[model samples]
Target chain A: MSMGRRLPVYLLLDTSGSMSGEPIEAVRQGIKALLSDLMSEPTARETVYLSVITFSSSAQQIVPLTELMSFQEPSLDANGSTAFGDALKVLEQCMDREVVKATSTTQKGDWKPLVFIMTDGQPTDSWESVADHIKQKKLGNVIACAAGPGADENMLKKVTELVVKLNSLQPEALKAFFKWVSDSIKTTSQSVAQVAADTPIGLPKPDPNNMIIVL
Target chain B: MNTEKATLKDGRTIEFVHDQPRSGTMKEVYFTPDRKSVVCFYKDPCAGSDANRLQRLQMILGAYNPTLPQSHGGAAQNDIEADYYRKLFCWPTGIVVQPRFGLVTPAYPSNFFFPTGPVWLKGEEKNGMWFIGPKNRKWFEKNQPSELGSLIQHFSLCLQIARAVARLHNAGLAHSDLSHNNVLIDPSKGMSIIIDIDSLVVEGLFPPDVLGTKGYIAPEVLSTIQLDLKDPKRKNPNARTDQHALAAFFYWYLLGRHPLDGRRIPPGNTAEEQDLLAFGSQAIFCEHPSDSSNRPEEKQYVPCSALGPLLYDLFIRAFVKSLHSPSDRPTALEWVRGFVKTWDLLIPCSNSSCLHKWFVFHNSTDIRCPFCGTRFKGTIPFLKLRAESRPGQWAMDGQLAVYNQLPIFKWHIYSRVFPSPETDRTRQAYCVFHEGKWFLVNEKLTSLTSPGGNRVPPGQAVELKDGAQIRFSQEHNGRIAEVQMIRS
Candidate 1:
C-alpha cells in the first residue's frame, strides 16, 4: 500500500574505448529514444524505473534506479580495460538495490521484471562469479541484447539466452540494433499491456541476421 | 537478504515467490528503490467467504485524497508517494496508520497478491515520471503482512493506477497527465488505480493544454500542446481529456506496452523511428479550412442517437471538426457511452485510440482517418488492407481480410486505405482463406466491423489457419487481384 510503484528497465552498456566514438553516441541516442518512446504511455511513465551501468575501465552505476521521466543518458566516455565481470556485478547489485528489497509489507510476490543488457567485448577481467549469478535467474531470458565489433559472442551468449552479433562496427548499426531493441520492447510491452499482469510471457525475439543470435 | 534466489522443488534450486497479500513470516524479500513492494509474511482472506474485503480494501485505499499532483507532467510521482505517506500516518479509525508509509505493512488484513500500490519519486524528464516494481516475491516467502488479506496472491508487485484514477473520477476528477508509465498493473489483483492525482479536474470542460505524455495525448488537446503550451492561457484541461485517454489506457492495460506501431526505422539504419502521428482532416491551425476537402459536407452532425453507438458522434467530432474546429468535439461522458458499448461488444484492439472500441464495417460508421484526419465520412462497404512490399515501394493492397498484428504474426498493410480527400483510391478485392471461403470487397470500402461486427465476419467465411497455407494474389491488370487459398 505504501510502497512505490515503478517499472525496472536495466541497460547493460559497454564502455570500451573502442566504443568511445559513434558507438557510444548511438547508444545514447537509442536510450533517449527509449525514454521518449515510453513517455507516451501513462503506465510506463509512473511505473517504468530505469537503471544504467557502463562497463569500461570498470562497471559504474552511471544512472542509479531512476524513472523514464527522470532518467538522463549516461555519457559513454571510453577508457581503461573492459571489465565485464565488474560490470555485471555492478549491474546485478544495482538491480538488487533498485528492484528488490526486504520489507515488513510484502507477504510475498514476484514482479516478472525485464532487463536489456548489451556489450561489445569479452570480459578482460574475471566474470565467472557474476556470470554464474546472472545465469541462474535465467538472466539469459530477460530480453538481453549483446553487440560490439570485438565482442565475444560466446561470452555474451552465456550472459543472455538470446544473443546477437552486430554485423558491422558502425555505431549506426549499434543504434539500429538498439532501435530494433526499442521496437521489440515496444511490441512486447504493448501486447502485455492488454492482459492483466502475471500472464506467462515468452521472452522477446528480435529479427536475426541484422543482429543475429550468437548464443 | 538473499534477494536473488527463488523457491523450487528439486536440486535445480528453482527460486520462486508466491505473491499473496496475507500476513505471515518468511525471509529476505527485495523491493525496488521506490519502495512500493516488499517480501514479508501475509494472510489469505480469499481462502474464505470474505469477498467484501477486496471492495473494502479498495475503499480503504480509496479513502485518501491528495492523489492530485502539485504540477503538470509525469515527474510528480512524489506527489503520489507523499500522499501515501501522509495518509498512512494521518488517516483514522479502521484506517489505522503506520510508520514510513504503513499501507503495505504486515499489521493489516490485506487482500493483495503483491505490494504494488505506492510508487516512490525517483527522477523526472521533460516527458513524465516513473516508479519501480518489486524485484521478486521470493523475499515474502518467509515473512508477510497481516492487515492485508490474500486475494490476488500470485500477481506481481506492480501498481494499476487506474483504480486510483477511477476513485478520483468517481470523486469528480480527471488525472491530467496519464501516460504509458503512470500505470502499473498488479495482474494478481485483477484491478487498477490512478496516480498523480493533484492535477485531476472534474468533468464537462476541456483542458487548455494536454497534460498526458505526447503520444498518449488526445486529438482535441493536440493543437494546444503542439501550439498553445507556450501561452499560459492556452492550457485547457478537463474531464474530457481523461475520457479521450481511456482508450490508450486500455491498450496499455492489455499489452504491457504502448499502442501505436509508430514508424519503423528506415531500412533498419537508425535508432529514431517516424516520430510523427498524423491527425486533423487537413493542416494544423493556420491552414485549417472552413470547407475542409476531407470534411464530408453531406454528413450532418446529428446529436448521438444513442450514446451506445460505437464511434458515431465522436467520429465526426474528432475527424470532422478535427481540422477546422477541434473545440467542437463531444464530451467525455458522451464518449464514455460509445466506449462502454465497445467494451460490451468484446472487440479488442491494440490501437491506442480504439483499443476495445469494436469498429464496424458499415457505410455510416464514423472514424478518425489516421492519414487525412477526418471524421463522419461514409465508410466503404467492402475494403481491407493487405501487406505487400516490392523492390521500390510498398502498398497496403486492399483485400477482404481482417489483418491483425499478432505477436508471432505481425503485419502492417502498406496503406490504411480509408476513404479519403481523405484520399480515396479504389479497387476490387477478395480475401481467400485456406478453408476456401472468398469475400470480395473494394480497396478502400467495406466496414468489416459493426455492432457485433467483431463476433462475426460479414463477408463470405474464409477460415485461414496459421502457416504457409495462406497466399494472396492480386488481379493481373491492376484490378483487385484474384485471391487464392491453397492448402499445402
Candidate 2:
C-alpha cells in the first residue's frame, strides 16, 4: 500500500507529585484504553500517529510519533513537581521534528497535529513565554485539561484557547476524559476530509456530570 | 444484565439492555433483550422537540419503507417482494417516543459481523472500508486472508449494491449518506445491505439528514459546503449525489483505490483547506485520459479498463464527464445493467494461486489475469447473442463467455427477460465441456433449435461448433447465440 498522509496526536501528561495513587493509575488505564480504542478503529489505525510526553521534574518524549497499530503504551509514574513549561517545550520540539509540511513537489503532508494536555497541579516552572508563543503561532489544535481544582484554568487558557475542566481527580473522571479523547480522535480521523479550513474539528461532548468546557 | 422497557409511538413496548450504550455522533444505540433489534436514541436534546423530525421518522417507518409489504404500510407490494428487498436494506421499523426521539431497527444480519479474528477485530462490523481502503486491505491480507474475497466476489457485491440502490431510486428515494459507514457488505457471500435507512431522502417530503461522509460526498456538495446549509446554491445529498457515491464505491471495490485521491496538492496552507479543494472544487479523476498529473504512482495498478467495456464506459462517464455534473451521471439502474452485462464476461483465472481467482474476459487478443499476470491457455468459446431487429434481420445485443458448467438463465435465453428482484432465476439451459468439445444442453427451453435447424429437446445436447448459430427460443424477442472460438 502506498504511504498516506498522517494525523499526528500528542498527549502531554503532567506526572507531578499531586498525580499519585489513584490519579496515576487512572492515567495508565486511560492510555491503555486510548490505544485499544484507536487501534480498533479502521480510520484511526490507518491515519493516526500517536506520541506521549510526560512531565514531572523534567519532561521527556516517552513515545515518539508512531503509527496506531505499532504504538506501545508507556509506563507512567507520578513523582516530581509539575514542569508544564518543559512539557510544552518538549511537545514543540517533537512537532517540529515530526509533523510533515506540504510541499509543491512531494505528496500532501501530515495534518495539523492534535495536542492534548492534562495536569492536576499548578506549573512549578516559568511557562508564560512558551505558552504565549504557542498561542500566537497557533501551533496546533491544543486542548488543555485541568484535571482537578488545584490546576489553574487561567494558566491553561493562556496556553490554548480550548480548555476543559474536571472537578475531581477521581479515576472514573479520568477514564471518562480519556474515552472522550479517543472518541474525538476517531471522529477527526474519520471525517478529516470534510472539515474546512479555520473551523476547528468538532469533538464529542463530554459527560456533563464529570467534565465541563472552560470558555 | 438489567433491562429497561420503552414505549414506542405505536403503543408497543420494547426492552433494551440498560448497559452503557454504544454512541455515534448523533445517537446512542442499545441492543434489545433478544439482540434482534436496536433502539437508537438521538443524543441531541432538541431532536425530540422537533415535530418535523418526528413526522419524517413516521413517514420513513411507514409509507416510504421498501423492506416491508404494503399490508404493513410499506411500499413493497407483497411479502415475497418485500422479503427480497428486506435482505438489501436494514430499514427502520418504528419510532420510540416515550424514552426519547429514537428509531427501532433490526439488528444487522450475523454475516455482516466478523465471525472470528484477532481480538480487536473479532465481532466487529464489516464496513466496506476494510475491503476498499488500501491500508485496511493490507492489514486483512496479512492478518486474515479469509476475510478478503476474490475479485469476482467483489464484483458480485458491487452488483448487489447497485441493485440495492436501484430499488431505493425506483421508489423516488435517495440514500442521503451512502458511504462505507452506512453500508455493510459480505463479499464472501456476495451480499450487501444498506443501513441507516431512516436518513433516506424521500423526494420533497423531507430534506437530507446529512451532507454525506468524507471521500463519498459528491463533488458539487463538497465544493459548495462553505455555503450556509439553507443556501439555495448549496447542493445537498440527493439521488444524483447517491449516484456519485455509488460510482466511487464501485470503482474502489473493483480497483482497490479511490477514484479522486491522488498526489496532486490543491492550493491551501491547512490540510482541511487542501482536502476541501482536492475532493471538491479542484477534484480530478486520477485516471483522466488527457491529464496525467493526478494519476496515482502505484506499481502494477490495474486500470479501470480491465473491468471490460460496459463497466469501463460507465466509469468514464462517472468520473470524467459527470464528476461535477450531477445530472449527467449514470443512474443506479444503469449501474445494475452494467454489472449484469459484466457478470457474463467473467472467467476463472488459470493460476490456481491468483489472488483475484477470476478476471473479466476483456476484448483483447492477449487474455490474462491482471492480479497475477497469468496468461490464459487453450481455446475459449464466446456466445455472441443477437436479437431480431426486423422480421429477419439480427442485431448484435451482447455476448457471454463460456466456461464448463455455466448455467444459462432466462435473461440469456430471452433478450427481454432482464434479471431483477422479480425475475425468474432458474436455469434455462447449461453448457458443458466433454472430450475436448463444448456442448449446450437444453434444460427448460421448449423451442430450442440446433445450428443445423434440428429441434434440441429438453435434456438433449447440441455440439457448440465454431460459427454455429443456435436458436434459444422461437418466441418473440428470443435470442440467437452465435459461437466464436479463440485460441490463446
Candidate 3:
C-alpha cells in the first residue's frame, strides 16, 4: 500500500528590525529543536512535512516543504519592516505548489496544513485583504502568535481564531512556545494517522506556568 | 500539583496524580501513586444516566468474573482468573468520585507503548493500531521474522480479537467505538488489547454515546445518522454494528486495506459528504466477487484471495452482502471458524523475502506461493482429517498442507476441544517435514496410535504415510485423521 498522506506544516516568522538579535536567534534555535523533537517521533517523521517562511522587507520561502529528516534550519538576519501581506501571499503560493489535492481517481493527497505565524511587531504593510483571502480559501488551520509588547493582537485576530500573546521574546518564553508547537504537531500528526485527514485535530494545552497568554 | 485521593466502592483509595494528567478530547487520564492503575477523569461531569450506566457495567463485570478453578483451588488460581480477564481486556476495575468523575483500570504494561532494546533506539513504539496499516509495515520490517511472518500468525491474531469481541457480546455488552484507534496491536507478539471499555453499550441499561470511529462504523448506522435521535429507524451502534467493525478489523489485519475504501466511488462535494457516501449509503466492497470496479490497485495491494477462498468468502459476506443489511453480517464465532479452517490450509513460501511467508494451498496441478509467486519445488504432504462431530459418525472435515513446524491445535484433533487460553497450551502438536520425510510430533497430547496399532506416546513421533490412519487421542470422541501424499 501507499505511504501515509503527508501533513504540511508552515512556520511563518517575522524577522523584522524589531526581532533583531535574541528574538531571531530564538526563532532559529526553536525551529531546530522542533525539527529534532519531531524527527524522534516515527509517526511525525513519516507524515509531517515542514516548511519555513520569513518576512521582513518581503516574504521568502527559506525552506520549501520537506520531510523532517531533510529539513535544514534557515538563518534569519533580521532587517527591514514586517511585510505581513507579502508573507501571506508567499504562503498561499507555496501551498498551491506544494499541497497535493485529494482526487476521485487517486485518493492520494496531503492532509490539511497547519500554519504557525510568529510576529514581534505590528504589520508595516496592509495584510488584511490577503489574510482574508487565504482564510476564505480554507488552506489550513492558522495559529498566529503575537510575540513581545509591540505585536498587535487585533491585527493577528483578523487572520485566525487561534491566537496567543507571548509576554516577551525571551529565550525561555520562546522555548516554551516552541515546545507547545512541537507537542501540538505531534498530537495532530498522530490524530491524522488514526482517523481521516478531515477529522478535527486536537491541539495541545498551553503551559499555564509559561507566560504565553492564550488570546 | 497536589495529588487527590478518592475512595472506590470496594473500600480501596486511589490517589490521582494531577501534575501530569494525560488529556484526551473527552477526559484526562491520571496515574495512581503506585503506577498500578489509572483514573480517567471526564472533562464534563457525567450525567445521572451515565453514572447509572457505569454502575451497571461494574455489576456486569463482577458477574462475568470466573469462579476459582477446582483443579487448582486457592487464592493463586483466583489471581490467575483475575489476570485472565485483565489480559483479555483493559476493563475498568473501580469507579472514582473525588476531584472529578472518573473510573480506574489497570495500567497497560510498558511493552504496549514501545519495543525493547534496539527497536526502541530506532524510535519505534507500539503507537496504537496505526502500526498495522499496510503503509506502516516497513516499521516492523527490520525485526527478525517480520511481523507479517506468516498467514498463520495473522489468523491467530484475528482469532484472538474475535474471541475477545465474542466474549463481550455474549455478556450483552457492545463496544460502541470499535475501531483501530481503540485497539492496540503488538505485531511482534501477534497479540492485541482492546481499550476504551468505558464507552461500552450495555443492552437496556445504556445506549452508545458515540457512533464509532469513521471507517469501521457500519454502513447502515452511517446512512441513518441524519434521522432524528428519537427515530426508531435511526441506527445506533450495537452488537450488529460491532460485527461490522470486527469484520473490518479482520479484513484490514489480513489484507492491509479498508474493505469499503475503493477507487470506484466518486468524490462528494465535501469531505464529510464523501465519508457519508464512501462508508455509508453508497458503500461497496473493494473486492466484491462480481464487481472488479472497486478492486484495489494491483500494483499496491495483493488481492484478498491471498488469505484463501474460505476467508475471502467471509469478506464477501461481510462487505458485499452485509454492506446494506446488518443481519447478513458474519458473526464473530463464524469468523473464528473461518480463520481456523483457513489457517489449516497454509503452506510456507519458499522465498525468504516475501512479507507474507505463507500462502493457502490451491490443490492445483502446479502449486505456487500466492504471496511471493514462487512455485513449490518438492512434493507436498497433505493431512486429511475425519471429524467425528458425534459418536459413531465421521466425515471428511478437510485437508491441510504439511508445512515444516506447522502447529496442530486441539480442535484439529478433538471435536470437543474448543480454542481458549485454558486449552491453548495443552492442545498443541506440530508437524515437521524434515530429511525427505514428514512426521507428527506429539507435544502435549498423550494419545497417538500408528497404523500398525502401536501407541506413540506423548513426545514421540509417528511417520506419516499415504492412507495411514492416526488416532490423535484415546478418548471416546477422539478424532482420527488419514494422511494423503501427493506428487506433482
Candidate 4:
C-alpha cells in the first residue's frame, strides 16, 4: 500500500516454562488488549505495523509484521526453556527481511523499529553473541522487561540499555506493564507522524512502586 | 511537592499543584490550584531576547481589549469581549518568576482537545493535529460521523481559523509556529482555538525562535536551511510564512491531503534529506495545475474541482500559482472571504450516505453529489445577488444555495461590513425553499423591498423569483441585491 512511513513494533515475548499458568494467560490477554488499544489510536493505526516473536525452547515467528487493521493476535503457549540467543537471531533476520532501508533513490525506508522483549527467567541458551550482533546493526530502540523474580536483569541489560524489572508476576502488574508498552508505542507513532523523526521518543515514567529500571 | 506559589510582575500570586505536571517539547505544564488555568515552565531558562519578547507580548495583550457599544457595554459586554478573545486564542494571561521562568494561560475546555482515554490515566488530551491526519480523519468520519459535521460547517471552521490568524496579524504579531499542532478545533460546533501564543513573532522585537512545523513551513524558509543561524540570508518564520501554513492547513482540512506530499519520493540517501526535498526547496503541489505526476489517486478523495470554481480558484492561487512566491500567496483575509463564499454556496446532498452531507453548488448542468455520486433529482435553486458598487454600476457580491431556513448574513446585504453578532444581528434574512418556489423572510429591523417598490417589513416574507431585485436596508447607500435564480 502507498502510505507514509511505517512504525514496525516487534513483541519478543518469552513463553518459557516459568511463564506457564497465570503469567502466560496474562501475556495472551495483555497482547490482545495492547493490539486493541493501539488500533484505537489513529496515528498508531496508520503508522504502527505489529509483529510477534515468541521464544521458548526455540524462537517462532508467530506473526509477521502487519498493519494493525489486519493484525490478528496469535495464540501463545508456554514451553521448554527461554532461548534468548535463538530469539535474537530470528529478530535480526526479521529486521533484515522486513524493514525497508533508505537508499539514494526513490524508495524511502520505514521508521526505526521498536522492539519490546518480556521474559520471566534466565535464557537457557547462550544469547550474548547474537545479542551483540544485533546491537552492532543498531536496529531501533529495544526495551527489555524482566518479568517476575527469576528473570535475569544483568543478562538482559547486555541486550538493551532500557531494561525494566517487574517485582512480582501478578496479573495486574503484567497488565500495567503491557499498558505502558502500548502507551509508549502510541507516543512514538505520534512523534514520527509529527516530524517524521527516527529518534527515540521520551518514554512515560514507569511505575516506581512495581517496575524499576535496571540500566 | 503538593503546591507551589509564584508571584506575577503585577503582584498577583498564583498557586500551582506539582502533583501532576505534563512535560511537552519545550516546557513543563502544571495546572493551577483552581484548575481553570495552566502554568508552563520552560525547561531551559529564557535567553535575554526571549525574556524581552515575552515582556513585549504582555504589553501587546494588555492593550488588546475590543471596544463595545455604550448602551450594551458594562461588565457584561466586557465579559463578552473577554470570552470572544479567549475563544480565539489561548493568550498568556500572566508571567511567572521565582523557581523558573513561566507563562500562565487559561486551561482549555475538556472538548478542546481529544481525550487520551486510558493512555494517560491522568486526563490529558492530544492536540488538533491528531484528528487532521488522513487515517485518523477517515476513522473519525466512519465511526464518529456526527462529530465531523457537514462540509459547510467545516468551511466555517476554516473561516474561524483564518479570522483568528487575521486578527493576530492585524495586531502586528505573527504566529510563527502556526500549524495543525498548535490549533485546536471542535468540528461539531465549528469552533477553533489557536494555542501557543507565547511563541508569537512580533516582527523586529521578537523574531521567530523556531523555524516551523515540518510540511507546513514555506518553501522559501526551507531553501534557507543550509544557511547558518546568524546568516543574513537565512529566512525566518514571519507573516508570509504564516500565510503559507494557513494555506497548507486549509488544503488539509478541506481535502484531507497534503498539498506538497505526493507519490514521487525525492531521491535522497536519508529520510531527512528526502523530507527536505519533498517539503522544502523542491516542494511541488500534488494537485499542481500543470503537473499530473502528483495528483491524488482517483476515488480516494473528493477532487478539488468539486469544491466549485470560486474556491478552486483560491486553492490554485494558494497551492499552484503562489507555491514559491510568498507575497503572491493569498492572505488570511482573502481565505476568510473565500471560505465565507464557499459556505454560502453549499447544498445538502440527497444521498443520506454521503460522507459530507453538503457539496458546493458548482452551478453545473448535471447536479450530482460529489461525495457519493448520487444525482440531485429536484430543481436546485441558486441565488446570485448583485449589489450596487458605484453610483450607476452593480457587481455580483454574493451567491447562495436556497435551502430551507438558510441564513443571509449582513455582509451579503451590506457592501461595507461583514456579519458578526457584535457587528450585526445574527442574520439579516432567511430563505425558505419549499415545493418548487422560494420565499425570503426579513429577520432584521431594516426594511426589505422588491423591485416593484413593495416593502416587506420585519416578520413578513416576500416571494423570490427569477431576476428578482431586493433592497435590503433604508440606510444610506443601502444594498440593492439582484437575485438570479438558476434551476439545475
Candidate 1 chain B weakest lDDT stretch, 10 residues:
B265-274
lDDT of 1 by residue, B298-331 (tens): 2332122222235445544543454234345454
Tens-digit lDDT track of model 3 for B1-488: 57888777567788877686665556788888878888887766643246665666565446543222324331114555545646756777777666555778877765556544343234343543445544345545655444444666666667777877877777677888877667766655667677778778877778888888756788888777777889999999999999999988787767767787766544654344455666788787888879877666555676777677888888888888877888888888888788778878887788887777778887777888775788877767788877776666788776678878878887788767666655665546888877889899888777778888888877889988888988888776677879888775
Question: What are the lDDT scores of the predictions, listed in order?
Answer: 0.40, 0.86, 0.74, 0.76
At residue B112, give the lDDT of candidate 1: 20
Q: List the candidate 4 regions with Cα displacement exceeding 4 Å.
A: A1-3, A13-41, A54-57, A68-82, A100-109, A116-215, B1-9, B15-35, B40-81, B98-101, B113-130, B207-211, B221-228, B231-233, B269-273
Candidate 4 lDDT at A193 equals: 36
**Residue-wise lDDT of candidate 2 within B1-488, one digit each (tens)?**
89999889989999999998878878999999999999999999899888778888887777878778899799888887888888888988888887787888999999999998877788888888778777788988787776788877887788888988998898888988988888898877778889888778877887887888878888898888889887999888999999999998898777888888877778888677777887888889989999877787675688998889889999999999999889999999999999899889988899987768888997568999888899999777899999998998999898899988889999998888898778899999999989999999989999999988989999999988889999999999999999998778
Instruction: Give per-residue lDDT, candidate 3, residue B107.
Output: 78
Using DockQ, give the best candidate's number. Answer: 2
From the highest TM-score down, the ranking of the candidates is 2, 3, 4, 1
lDDT of 3 at A51: 94
Best by lDDT: 2
Which window of ten consecutive residues has the lowest lDDT sum in model 4 chain B?
B67-76
Ranking by lDDT: 2, 4, 3, 1
lDDT for B438 in candidate 3 is 89
> What tens-digit string does per-residue lDDT give for candidate 4 at B1-488?
49998777667889999875765656789998888999888766653246576666565446542222223321114655555656777777777775677778888777765543334211434445446676667766666666676787778778888888887787677888877668877777777888887777878877777778755788888777677878998888999899999988888777777777776677665455566677777788888878877766444767777888767887788888887888888888888888877778788898987877888877767888887888887655566666667767767777777778888777777777774435655777888876767888888846788778988888988877777777777665567766666655
Q: How close is candidate 1 to the true structure, as a TM-score?
A: 0.33
Looking at candidate 3, what is the lDDT of residue A47?
Answer: 73
